[model samples]
Target: MRLVVFDVDGTLVDSQHHIIRAMTAGFAAAGLEPPPRAEILGIVGLSLPVAVAQLLPMADLATQARVVEAYRVSYMQARGERAAPLYPGALDCLDRLSARDDLLLAVATGKSRRGLDAVIAAHGLQGRFVSLQTADGHPSKPHPSMLWQALADAGCEARAALMVGDTSFDIQMARAAGMPGYGVTWGYHPAEALDAAGAALIAEDFHHLTRAIEDWAS
Candidate 1:
């Protein structure tokens, strides 16, 4: 059977507002300044610590860690206020993919296990994925560990797996894991960035993405 691995934020859902707001709180808690919106969004697919470090390169490790914790708290609070919504057609695409008997769906994301769980619970996506790899147990994206573990969990070979996401880190991670990566345009990064990161195809929307995945599988 083939495996289709997905990214969470900026892929299936739009968490930019919550992310930016939490990041602002994180910086506030740390008595620092948050980066610009574009700069912050640029690191959407990375683990908390890694993303924090990128945003605060000059800060000490302790401060970065503090910001990470604060971000987590703020995110959880914001999440309760408003759950991030899935992009239009995401459910339909997932439904279509799930209907296929020859494939298994999985998630490989930078979100912590708690955060991923929250999203899944909020969206009633329990049992939607055969494997769920998160930052809690794996390195951030652009590292192949999550995808490697996902392959093992899904009993899929790298050649038989497809990675679908919106960021360069996702494409790079898929490349490092020896899998073909498909990019979605409606997410965080631009199409050029994804193409530069070695995406096999850049889909315009979920409908196009589902078709692309099916075409690739065939």
Candidate 2:
């Protein structure tokens, strides 16, 4: 079966606002200034600790760890106050893709297993994926470990799998894993960055994303 692996944040769900807010609170709790929204968006596909390190390159490891914990607490609190909704057409695309018997679906995300589980349950997406690889057990995005584990779990070859996401990290990871990557414009990173990162094609919307995948599959 052909495998389709997807990213979570900035890919399926639009959690930018909540992410920015929580990150701001996190930095505040850590007694540091928050980075710009654009800067934060650029790091969406990375694991929390790695992302925090990038955001606070000048800070020591202890400081970064504190920021990570603060961010997690802040994010958990924010989740109670607001839900991060899937972008329009995201569910439809997933539904259509899942209906194809020749295809297998999976998730390769930088989110922790608990976070991924929460999103799946919150969106009622349980059982839709055949494999779920998360930061809890694997290295962060752009490392290719998540994709490698996902492909192994699905028993699929690299060439038979595609990574779908919105960031350069995803595209680079797919490349490193010897697979094609498809970028969706409605997500985090800019289209130009996606293209530069070796995306085979960039889809402007879910309809285009579906068509692009089908075209590749055919």
Candidate 3:
């Protein structure tokens, strides 16, 4: 089977606002100031633990733990009330891709299982992804565990898979997995940065994304 793995936060969902807001609350909970938005945004694709570490390098272990806890609580509450918006055409792209018999869809995201579950259920995207590789199970992006797991779950070889995402971490992970990576321009990372990271191609919109996949699979 041909497999496609997508990143959730920046690619499929525009979740930066919620993430940043919770992070700010987390800092307050830990009695530390939140990092600047640019600094926080730069580490967008890292898992929660990693992101927290990067954002608060001087924070002690106890403080870090407290911050993470607060972040989880804040994020969960906010997510229920207001989950991120799906990128334009993201749902449609999923729909088109999942319709093919030869294709197997899955997620490789830095989101927690709980977070991904919220999105899937909210968007009526259940069962559209055969497998989910969340931060809870393995090392986050820039690591190949998520992609590798998705390949195994989808019953496809790495070479037959494509990683679709919007960050350098996604491209790096795809590289490590020996899979082609397609970067989406509308996500967190700039197109130039994605290109520098060795993305196989960059898609400007969902139609372009679909065409690339169709061409690849054809």
Q: Write the per-residue lDDT of candidate 1 for residues 1-218, one digit (tens) a residue.
A: 99999999999999999999999999999898788999999999999999999989989999998899999999999999999999999999898898899989999999989899999999989887999999998888899999999999998999999899999999999999999999999889999999999999999999899998888777
lDDT, candidate 2, 24-105, per-residue tens: 9889888888998899999999999999999999898988888888889888887777778988988998999999988899
| TM-score versus the correct structure, for each prediction | 0.98, 0.98, 0.96
* lDDT (10s digit) by residue, model 3, range 157-212: 99899999999999999999999999999888899989999999999999999999
**What's the number of clashes in each of the models?**
0, 0, 0
**Pairing residues by index, what is the TM-score of model 3?**
0.96
Off by over 4 Å in 3: none
The positional error of residue 168 in candidate 1, measured at the CA in angstroms, is 0.2
Give candidate 3's error at residue 98 in angstroms: 0.6
Minimal lDDT window, size 10, model 1 = 209-218
Clashes of 2: 0
**Model 1, residue 46: C-alpha shift (Å):** 0.4
